[model samples]
Target: MKIIVNAEQRDVSGCTLAKALEELDFISTAIATALNGCFVPREQHAETTLSEGDRLEVLAPMQGG
Candidate 1:
């Protein structure tokens, strides 16, 4: 499926958020995610489904102030 990830177009095979993250090599990283402008809790990542044209934002915490 095609989805906009962090403003870039990406082709992912996983339909669920957790699977997508694993495909994108972000499974073990500490990051926050928002789907289609809505915040998605960490606990729900495994159940959150993704669709084509969906906007996904993956944000990682910065060390600097």
Candidate 2:
């Protein structure tokens, strides 16, 4: 399926958010995810379903002083 990740188009095989993260090499990284403008909690990632044309925002924390 095709989805937008961080403003870029990506083709992913996973049907759930967790699987998609793995496919994108972000499974082990600490990040925040939002689906179609709504926040998806970390605990729900495994059950969150994704569809074609879905817009996802994956945000990683930045370190700064």
Q: Which candidate is the best by TM-score?
A: 2
Cα deviation in Å at residue 50, candidate 1? 0.7
Runs in model 2 lying further than 4 Å from the true structure: none
Please give the lDDT score for candidate 2. Answer: 0.95
Which residue pairs clash within candidate 2?
Answer: none
Mark the regions of model 1 whose C-alpha exceeds 4 Å error after superposition. none
lDDT per residue as tens, model 2, 6-44: 999999999999999989998755899999999999999
As a whole number from 0 to 100, the lDDT of residue 21 in candidate 1 is 86
Task: Please report the TM-score between candidate 2 and the true structure.
Answer: 0.94
**lDDT tens per residue, model 1, 1-65:** 99999999999999999999889888755899999999999899989999999999999988976
